[model samples]
Target chain A: MQPPVLELVDLKKNIKNKEIIRGINLTLGPAEILGFLGPNGAGKTTTIRMIVGLIRPTAGSVKICGYSIADDFIRAMSNVGCIIESPEMYKFLSGMENLRQLSNMDKRITRQRVDEVVELVGLQKRIEDKVSTYSLGMRQRLGIAQALLCRPKLLILDEPVNGLDPAGITEFRNLIRRLAHEEEMAIFVSSHLLSEAQLMCDQVAIIRQGSIVKTATVKDILNTETVEWRLDNPVKAARLLKEKWGIEALRENGNTITAAVGENRLELINQVFVNEGIELRYSIPRQNTLEDMFLDLTEGDEIA
Target chain B: MLRLIENEVFKIIFKKRLLIVFGILLVLITAFAYGQDNSLNRTKARLAGRIGITASTDWKKLCEQQIIDLKNRLESPYGHEEDKPATRVRIEQLQYYLENNINPLDSSAAKFTTQFMEQSIFLFLPLLIIILAGDIVSGEAANGTIKLILTRNIPRWKVLLSKLAALLMLEIIVLLMAAVISAAVSGVFFGYGGWTAPVATGFRVIGDRLETLGVVNVPQWQYALMVYGLAYFVSIVVGTVSFMISVLVKSTSASIGVMMSALIGGNFLSHFMSDWKITRYLFMVNLRLTDYLAGSFQPVAGINMAFSVTVLSVWAVAALAISFVYFMRQDILV
Candidate 1:
């Protein structure tokens, strides 16, 4: 009976007569992680900007903790923490000082909480050094520390791991999962790294050209079965599968055919190919990855 | 809001902007004090060469001689009609100094403090204020830290208001630095002994005539306070205008450039177009607010202290309104 931690209803935006975001609606509950995936110029950043109050929406509402962003901005924003783009801090100040500056803005934050977040992000080693001297990975950690200062109920991260190493990325994924599951916080993350998202996200929403084209659970997306056929004369094999067995197979390459048939059908499919005039090399069942689903949904647009 | 202002003040302090302003004041004040001492010694030497040993003790003779020369120039009929009133005022000032037994050439730290502010109000003081206030808002935008602040739980107007308050506080500090540095530096050269000296003020020019009814003599310290007060007013006006420009422009260097050009261009416009009636209404033309207290000559015809203050107040208010409205409604695309 509790309201969702973050909600967007009929969100829209227009810039100089060009529609940038067209009626985006989403809801995130407690302990949920939604990966917002989109190609370049697809309104991903624009949508994040609107949620953080950086850009005004043409028509719609962003509500946080049951408070409308437009009418109760301070209250709504108090419940949310975000990094819209790159995590930029005051370079002249030490990392600890930057955290102190942000902590001062909210009344609920305390000195103990600051140190806790610093330890949480593993920035305690170099926290007292000037941010200008900190590496990109360190700055990213400090930014996450700043966002966690007020114990926000909803966290929004845009390309949070763009500059991180593989180990850092894995560590960040674990931290995000822990935050969501243990703290019961709703997190919305926009990322171009689909493999990372596949490991970190519970659900994925792929957007294209200012509209949500697909939204599904990661488990559902990865659970969809398919059989790939590696054989001679893929064109003839595809036609034969469609005509004889009423199956639609996609010609992925010159000599390979993929169909949404279960793994049990692979043996029969191989037999069909052998009985026919086609020379069968092999047949294997494969699970769709988030990358594969993302490419299929976006039609290979440039992912930024 | 207090925390916000504290944040702003610390940011400016860490940026070393106030230190730069203080450094500039120290260097310029020292140079001007040295120049003044040299000029005063040169005048003393010239007077000693013309007269005998009595030149140092007898200032009345020099005053009378200068008055006589001015009177002769007034009667020669070779002077421009428009310049006659200023000459007559200078002659009257000399005669009044003689009557009051006050030597016009007796320089002191108090006198230097007042004089320095009067000379710097129109250009130097305003430039220092611009350096302090020009990037309060735009610097954050340029460096990408504006998003960090704007994404916090504070309202947009509160953020801007805190910045303005911090700027005003720093402007006061700048004026204080100018006064203290000028007085301190000049005292070492001028002997620091004129705080109780009498100074004449409240002179008015009404239609090509010197109006002396309002003239009164106050102590040199009181006179310095009035001059610095006027300078502070001018500083606030300049600071507010530049703060507004900071909001309108996102790049710090561009904001500073725009304000600098407008200020310098206004100075030139006031000189080249003094005859234009609209020129008197410009805030830049009225920046020399201390001139009214010192009873200096006016280049343009109809502006008085009340008129200048009104013009400046209008400009400051308009700029503040524009800044708040625009900032509140802006998308902050950067």
Candidate 2:
């Protein structure tokens, strides 16, 4: 219903005669969390960098909040807050002072906004401490606090959870959800953790070798399609389901069979298997996970 | 722009190394004042002992007392004509020597004394400039902060402009401190009242027409102003050159090292190039613009202060232009 907050129109980037990104197009709508998934050197950082105006794309344009990054950089960048790679910080300054310095980049940022973001990132207690003394998680929190300083309408983070521990990652996930839900901000984050992306993102865009392989809603990608089943013997189960229910299924492994079966047909397969005296180890229709979808889509090494 | 400039200035003042440099200047100025005072006292004592009188706080009073002593002995009721000639001759000889041979106790020597008291330009001011100018952009690049600052949506030129402006401000601040320190220290020993005293360094450089360049007469304060202007110009030239190197090298040590070598090498080259007409055009040759004050080396047989200023000016502008263009286009990948 609303126009996309961020758009990449056939973006192509070439450096020293080597193409990095090839005709990549993407759009991030308002209040949506789009996970940019890619392996190392897969152009995730490169694409995010172009969106933040860090590097000029060899071809095409990136628009932030309807303003082109090249045509109107000030206006476009004024509303976009980003953390590319590891957040660069002045280590000698206090965490709060780092936020204060970044806050000065935009006139709209106020003292109250700084305080709010510091607390939002759960760093209020340690905000007065020098950045050099901070843990990796605290530093990332401080970086995010700075990014949120100007109350940017769109937030772009590259590997925001890379160095965070479990607790820090959970807090970061909650904070990002709050920003998108309560503040109505569009957040585009790049991460190699597909499970984390599945748990946190509303939508996910899979990138392989600098190109987007797929983009879909988390519900559609994980919950609504392609049921997988685990049985005592996948080959025997596949044969039994094919003969009795007239349903075709593929053997995934020694004991796992995946089938595109309707909801009603799931009961029929289980009943036939039970009558044949086949002991069921795990026979429920398996919901597809982000990791499974990722492996299914990408051809090369799956994990980044 | 003003706020940006203010922020830049704040960054400079907060740097601990720069603060220490200023502190060192203050200590040196204090030590110099003490040494000059001790030397003045010792000279007064030595001269008073030769005249067979104790050194007094007031030297003119001592001379007047000597004249009255001679007059009293001449007008005494027990005095003989024989005693009169000897006393009169003694008084006349002393008066002639005092008037002709000895320097009048005046503020005229303040300029020469102050210069001798303080470390010359070759040592002090250039080192001060190096403390700040050496790290202008290279420090940021070396620390990996350039990428952060540049990515903040501000134009690259604005960042460079802020840095250049900040360094210039720091230069002005340091020069001003030096001026105040020099004045205060020079004031203590010289007893502070001959701002208009003529200061002539006894050195001379013979140019075309055997033109003696050193004896140009100017008021002490005016002479100080000339020195300030010359040093100020040199600082600008150094700042611009160091800034260009800062942009090119991307390491603080390299930028400072290259500029220092250039600075030292420039002085060395000028020594041999006093007769080289083409060497007069070298940027470093004009570095000692104030040397023309002390009747030191002139770049060419006929070159003047205006010619030196022109050479330094051209070099500074060219360096800044290169810095401005290259920094805006740098990859900033770090």
- What clash pairs does model 1 have? none
lDDT for each residue of candidate 2 in A135-192, tens digit (9 for 90 to 100): 8888888778878887888999888997799988988899899899998999999998
lDDT, candidate 1, A1-304, per-residue tens: 8888989999999999988889999999999999999888898999998998988899999999898888889999998888878899999999998988888888899999999999999999899999999889999999899988989899999999988999999999999999999999899999999999999999989989898999999998888888887888998898888887788999896798888875466677777778887998888788889998888888966643
Judged by lDDT, which candidate is best?
A: 1
Where does model 2 exceed 4 Å of error?
A1-3, A224-284, A295-304, B27-124, B185-194, B200-216, B272-282, B299-304
Can you write out model 1's per-residue Cα lDDT over B1-334, one digit (the tens) per residue?
A: 8998999999999899999999999999999999999988887777656765454688888778778878888888888776677788788878777887778888899999989999999989988988988899999999889999998999999999999999999988998999899989999999777999999888787756667779899999999999888888898899999999999999989998988888888898877788898888778899988878867678788789999999999999999999999999888677
Show where candidate 1 strays beyond 4 Å: A230-247, A252-255, A262-281, A300-304, B51-56, B69-85
Cα displacement (angstroms), candidate 1, residue A291, comes to 1.9
Model 2 pairs in collision: none
For candidate 1, give the lDDT of residue B130. 88
